[model samples]
Target: MKAVILAGGEGCRLRPLTNHCPKPMVPILNKPVMEYSIELLKRHGITDIIMTVHYLSSSIRSHFGDGSKWGVTITYSEDGMPLGTAGSVKLAEQMLTESFLVISGDILTDFDLSAGIQHHEDQLAAATIFTKPLDLPIEYGVLLSADKKMDKMFEKPNWSDLTKHSINTGIYILDPKIFTYLEDFTHYDFSKDVFPAILKHNEKISIFEAEGYWSDIGTLATYREAQFDMLHHKVNLPSKGKEIAKGIWMEDGVTIHDDVTLKGPIYISRNTIIHEGAIVGPQTVLSESAIIHEKSEITHSILWENSYVGKSCSLGGMIGHCQIQDHSALADMNDETVNAWREYTKRDS
Candidate 1:
C-alpha cells in the first residue's frame, strides 16, 4: 500500500506544450501521460512509489528514474514551490508510513485500486476519497455519502447539494494519521483544506464510489479528449503498437511507402516514415522518430517524437514537437508561421 504520484501541476493548460513537455510528459497514446499512472499503480500491487515533483522537475526526474522501468521503487518528493492539492500530499509526509495512495499524475484512470484498498481496510478508514458519478457536478467538489461515511462537502455543489452525482476522483487512501490534517507551510486542500478539516473534527472520512474510466489531463481540451479516449478503446490501455491492420498500430522500425493511403485508429511509432502520396489516419498519432514526406494529409493528428512532416504538407493539427513545413492547410501557416506558433503549438495538449 504505497503510491503518491501527485506530479506537481505546471501544465498551465498545456501551453506551448508545457513549454517543452512536463505535464507528466504529455503524449497519451505514444505513452507518457505519467505512463498511465505508472501502469495504474503497477496494476494495484502498488510498487512503493512517491513522485511529488514540482513544475518541470527535471522532466519528471529524467523520465521515471528510480522507478526501475516501472517495477517501481521511486521516491523523489522534490517540490520547492507551488504545493497546493493538500500541499502536495503534505510533501509526501515522511514517505507516507502506512497505507498510502493518492493519485494524479495528470490522471486517466482504470481504478480498481485493489477495490479501493479493500474498502479502506473494511471501513476502519482514516482517510479515503475516490468518487465518481459526475454528470456535471458543475466544476467539481461534491461528495455526500451516508453509510460509507463522508457526510458532506459541497464547494461548487448545487441542485440542493445533490441527491446523487458526486465528484472528487483525485483518488486517495491515506492514514499516516492523515498527517494530522496538514500544516507544514500551509496551502492544504484535499477538497479545499483537508476534507473540511476532517468534517470539522467529528472525523470519519471514507467514501469509495469508483468503477472505471476517469479522465483529467486538464485542458488542451481535456488533452484532446484524452487522446480520442485512447483511440476509442475507452481506456484499458496497453496498445503501444502491433495491431498492424485493424486500427493499424505498427511499431518495429515502421516505413510504409507503396503509395501509402492507410487509415484506421492509427498509431505508428518507433522509427516511423510513410512517404508516397500519404493519407495518414482517422485519428493519427505517430511518435518515435516520425516523418511523413510525400503528399501529406494527416487527420485528427498528434505526431510528437522527432517529427518532420514537410513535403506536400496538408497536415491537420498538433503535428509533432517542432519542425513543420507548409504545403497548405493548418490555417495556411504564414504570418511568420503565425508569429512562431504563438502557443497554439499546433493545436491541443
Candidate 2:
C-alpha cells in the first residue's frame, strides 16, 4: 500500500533550532523524527511512500533517498506553493491515486495502522480518521461517534463537547477520491475544511480509535521529553543510546579528562570534552563538540552543538547552543539567569 507523509511545514514554533534543521530532521535521541514514521510504515507492509516536501526538502531527500534501505519505494511530491494539511495530501493525489494512509512527519506514535485500515475498509468510508483521547479537548477537534461510527467532527470545543470527545490523531486512511473536495488556490486545513465538508454531505468519515503512545515533538520541551521517552524504551528504536559503560552512552571521539565526575543517564555526543573536576549529568545531553571547563557543574540540561560551559558555572534547566568569538567562552545561560530574584547580571554583554 502507498502512504503519504506530510513533511512540508517550516516549523516556525521551533525556531533557532529549526532555523538550522527542518522540524522532521530534528533528532529524537539522535534519530530523525521522520525515520520513525518511515520505519512504522515499512513494518506494516506499506512499501510505497510519497513525501510531500517544501522547506528544506533537499535534506530529507538526501537522507532517505529511494527508501530502499528501509525496504520501501519512496517518491517526492514537492509543493511549489504553501499547501495546508488536506491540500498537501490532495497535491499528492497522482502518487496516491489509490487507497492510502496519511500521517504527519513530526508526530510520534505507536498507533495501529493496520487495524485502522481494516476498520476503514469495514465501514466503507471515504476517510477513516484516527482518533486519540486527550485530557483536555478544548484546543482540539472533538470526534463524535455512536455505535463505533463517527457521526461528526467539532473542532476547538467547549466543556460540553469535551464530555464526549475523541481527537484527530492527524493520521488517516484516505480514499483518493477525497481529493475532489480540495479547492485550488487556497490553504485547506484538514480539520477545518475537508472533514467538515465530508460530514455535511453525510459521507461516512469513520473513526479508528487507538489507545497507544502518541506525542507531537512540536516544541523544545516535548522534543526533550521524546528523547527521554526513547531512552526509557517507551518508544522502541534500533539502538537505545550507545553504551560506554553499564548505563552510559558517550558519543564517539568524546574526551573526558581525569578527575571529572559523572552520574548515570549521561549522553555525551561526539567531540565533547569534560575537563578535570567538572561534574556532569544524572540526566543530561551534551550535543556534539560541547566543552565543560574545570569544576563546572551541569544537570538536567541539554547543550547544543559547539557550546562551552565556563569554569565554576552551575546549570539547571539550561540550553547552551553555541560558542563565542575566539573560542574564549560559550554563549551559556540557564533558568537561573532568567529568574530575576537570583540577582545574576549578564557580564558577557
Task: Return the number of clashes found in candidate 2.
Answer: 0
After TM-score superposition, the amount by which residue 23's alpha carbon in candidate 1 deviates from its true location, in angstroms, is 0.7
Model 2 residue runs over 4 Å out of place are: 240-257, 270-273, 288-294, 305-313, 324-349
Candidate 2 global TM-score:
0.83
RMSD per model, one decimal = 16.5, 5.7
Q: Model 1 reaches what TM-score against the true structure?
A: 0.35
Give the per-residue lDDT digits (tens) of candidate 2, residues 1-349: 7899999998887777788677888766556788999988987888889999999999999999999988999999988888898887777676777788989999888887889888889999988889888876676678888876777677787787555768888898888777788876568988888878887877778888887777877766566566655555566545434776744777678899999998756678888888889888755778777888888877766777678777777776555374422223332345532342122112111
For TM-score, the strongest prediction is 2
lDDT of 2 at 211: 71
Q: 212-237, model 1: which lDDT tens digit per residue?
A: 89988876656766766676567787
How well does each candidate superpose onto the true structure, as a TM-score? 0.35, 0.83
